[model samples]
Target: MSDVNQASQTLLDSNPASQRIPPSVFLLTGAVAVIGSNSLVLSPIAPEVAQSLGVSVPMVMSGTAAFGLGTAASALFLARHIDRIGAWRMLRIAFMLLTASLLVSAAAPVAFVLVAAQLGAGVAAGVALPAIYASAAAIAPPGRESKTVGIVLTGWTLSLVAGVSISAVLADWLDWRAVYGAVFLLAAGAFAVLVFNGHRDKVSTEPAALPLAALTIVGVRPLLLACGAFMTAFYGVYAYLGDHLHSVLGLPISANGLVTLVYGLGFGAAAFLDSLEKRVSPRLGLPAAFLAVALVYLLMAMENGTYGAILALAFLWGLANHLGLNLLIVRLTALEPGRRGAIMGLNSAVTYLAVFAGPLGFGWLYTTAGFGALAGLAVVLMVVAILAAYAAPSTPRN
Candidate 1:
């Protein structure tokens, strides 16, 4: 049998009818969609939520910051226990917390309550995200890990395309409270599916080590550095992208949404190429993905004067980003498969840290220098990521 066939057969032989593609991958994707949507939905609905709570928009926006703090703190301090606790069980608890958070937010009578609820949601996200990524790596068919993980990552695209937009519509027509209620329903549905059909996730019998210990493994640090730089670059540019379009290109808020829609489409479309990643060596593929992103940023910086060009580049940008993210997850999880929870927890921590730092750093550059300078900062970051990728220990092609 070929490698692909043999891998599939081995999966079936090892765990028949319990865990495989479609069902397993689909459930994980659904779970991620709920988590990703909750993280994003708050920003778009801040105005409505603020007005309803009788607070300023910025005060209401504190909910997002609270969520970010909770995610970063939980990922850094709490997620390591997934190794001792098991991804399946951690995911269960995370989902329960997430559902409760949404329920609280839906009924919150004050801004403080909303912020507190979102913080709880963030904690759930911190736990749920690593568990979901680790679980994807754990159950994937041997030779198809990249493709499987890529498929699961598309949940972000779904959240971007459907979740946030739908929330906006629901808030406009119904109520902002209804938006949280809807997300709560989605979370509850995913939790039900997880309870009934979720695959058993392996736990380390040895006590879970500190998240820092994952750094001791060779090649892990450089990969994480690359992960940090990659996320920072993307989020930095992304945070200001809509403002750039509106201020520079004279696009309205509605038109700005079109750019995000195009990006989401490209992100989802790139998943088809993930299967090809398995044929290429990580040493070659990893840097190549980073380079592609660098090129797109360069093009955007040079071509930002044109609305049409910026829109077109957004698609390419999303495409490159998805591939880069897929490689990061595949490579990181491959390094020490048994310690995936701890390692991915560190990944989540770095990611949330970027979510905080990126906007501030890039916002400064954007304010003082301009969009070109902001893109320049992104280019510099990507170059650093490229160098780190080159310095990373070379793994043999799977």
Candidate 2:
């Protein structure tokens, strides 16, 4: 049997009555889906939101920026508490906060109100995401860490597939308010599940590391730098892909949606490859994944003129990204188990900081130069990630 399958058999032999996958993992996955969906749902319905709030589309997009800003701030400052307070408790609090924020967003009277609500949700997500990752790592059976993390990360695929698609339909049929309302229901449902079924962690007596202290941990700084580069490249390209398709390629919005669907499909497909990482050391596997991303960006830069090439590259981009992301999380979570909440919080902080900064920097490049120049910059960023991953300290296997 493959390592993953054998690990499953081991888990099964240990607990005959239990499902191969634990209920808690699924619950954690649901929580991740809630946060992921909230992050991405704004783009497809931006026009509807703008029209409803009587604001320009740029003003509506500022809500997304506000959300990113809030997340970055909270992740840096507040996520350290997850270790001290316990991951499960932090997650429950996040769910409550998310539910309340979504409700406020659904009922908001103006664009500013909507932005404020999204900012609140972003704060909740900052802590919620690190707690979710820490919880997933904590609950993983021996030798199943990669498979388990891959499964929880699939929540992003859920967001890409169901979240954005459904929000668009709801906006078209009901109104933009229904989109937030639906997310509110999902958040509330996940909160209910955690309240009833989730296990409580014994609060640690160990004080959580401050953000600066977290950087002192072995491998953290380079890993976080890699993470920032990886995310910046992704967000930079993603921010303009649809516009590139629409204005340059003259493809309809539906076609752009299809491209996103293809990317999501590719992301989901990469989950099957996660088990393969068990056989290879992450030191080798991570750099290879990062190199794959670098290659994809290079191809995108060279082939920016072709629709078919762009579509195919998008799939490869998603696939490489999934592998890179999985390895990054696994390594970070392994580095200092007791301090995972703090480390992963740094991960989210850098990621959201990239979310705020990537587009702005890439936008200037794209406007002054071109898509080719923008993608070329992404390639350079991926190169930085590859080098940082190569130089980082090794992680213990779970």
Candidate 3:
């Protein structure tokens, strides 16, 4: 048999249905890392990127929204096609598109082009990420589905640590554009892996239509709302984090990487505690995490001018963020297994929707109301998420 056929046969021969995570899962996780990082890669140097592109920091921050816009559109439109087109092909396409977008971003001379490139990058991310989730769940051993998800999401967690920490320092030494160049190299590497993997994902065999099935999930509503709040609270500060540190707190640009590393370490660590959630109800665990995040936001806003507080608060936020968000994702994958692709697609759509709104809304608040106002609002949203999680039923839709 040919390599593609041989690879397909290998998948059948030792399917994850009967075993632990396939080694190939690591390859897909690498793809998730780069795609997840692309959305925030410029965040560490928002001011510098703004200056290079001849725009205000807020205007450059609008690129975050543009990315969300593109991703949301894709999550809505393209996710359904995953079953029809096949996951491997969609992943390949996502990889190529991301590579092209990164090149555009690295080479852009003006702000608009850069924003457009981010949008393109988001499109690639929208297609690739949910597909990975869907594929992971399908391939996971019966009881290990959520754990598989945790492993994949840890890629995102590590990327936040490694990508931000390294790129922030590089941006200081080289330039804002150097960050995209580095990501481009990484994306190119992922593409090469996909090319060599030589197996395609099987199409869904579900009875329900993607639209109707996705629309009808009872558990999804509360989860989506909670997720929206989660992203807004995060990107709200995250988009302007560099500015908050450098301009407001009077810290040097180098501090961004260090603080992000602290946050990412906490995030990465939380994955290990995934099994602990079984002891506590999600109703309790989820809301408690949200509450913790709200408290962190409140405290960070009220802190004195010390890196110690910033680092500690961020670590706490990262820990809670990882626990809550990954729990939601694992629950989502299990929510309506029949319509998983569409469900994940919708979940991703909501995520980007929140991302689109967070920076734009928070940027506006930062302009008018100040950082304290933003943090206070985050508290309110977390409270809302807490209530939603409580009100939302624990059972999946029928």
Q: The CA-based lDDT of model 3 is what?
A: 0.81
Residue-level lDDT of model 1, residues 78-157, one tens digit each, is 89999888888898889999999999999998899988999899899989899889989887875667878998999988
Show model 3 residue runs off by greater than 4 Å.
Answer: 1-19, 205-213, 396-398
Residues 1-398, candidate 2, lDDT per residue (tens digit)? 89999998887768845425567888788788889888877766765677778886556666777777788888989999988898898888888998999999999999999999989998999999999998888888766788888999988888777776667667767888988999999999989988887497966798777666889888999989999999989887776676567667876545555666667778889998866777778788898999999999999889948888887987888788899999999999999888888888999999988877776667678667877888899999999999999899888686
Instruction: Give the range where candidate 3 is weakest over 10 consecutive residues by summed lDDT.
Output: 204-213
Which candidate do you rate higher for TM-score, 2 or 3? 3
Model 3 RMSD vs true structure: 5.2
Question: Which residue pairs collide, candidate 1?
Answer: none
**lDDT of every predicted structure (CA atoms):** 0.81, 0.83, 0.81
- Using lDDT as the measure, which candidate wins? 2
Report the Cα lDDT for residue 45, model 3.
Answer: 83
Off by over 4 Å in 2: 1-19, 47-58, 171-174, 304-307
Position 367, candidate 2: lDDT: 64
Relative to the true structure, candidate 3 reaches a TM of 0.92
What TM-score would candidate 2 get against the native? 0.89
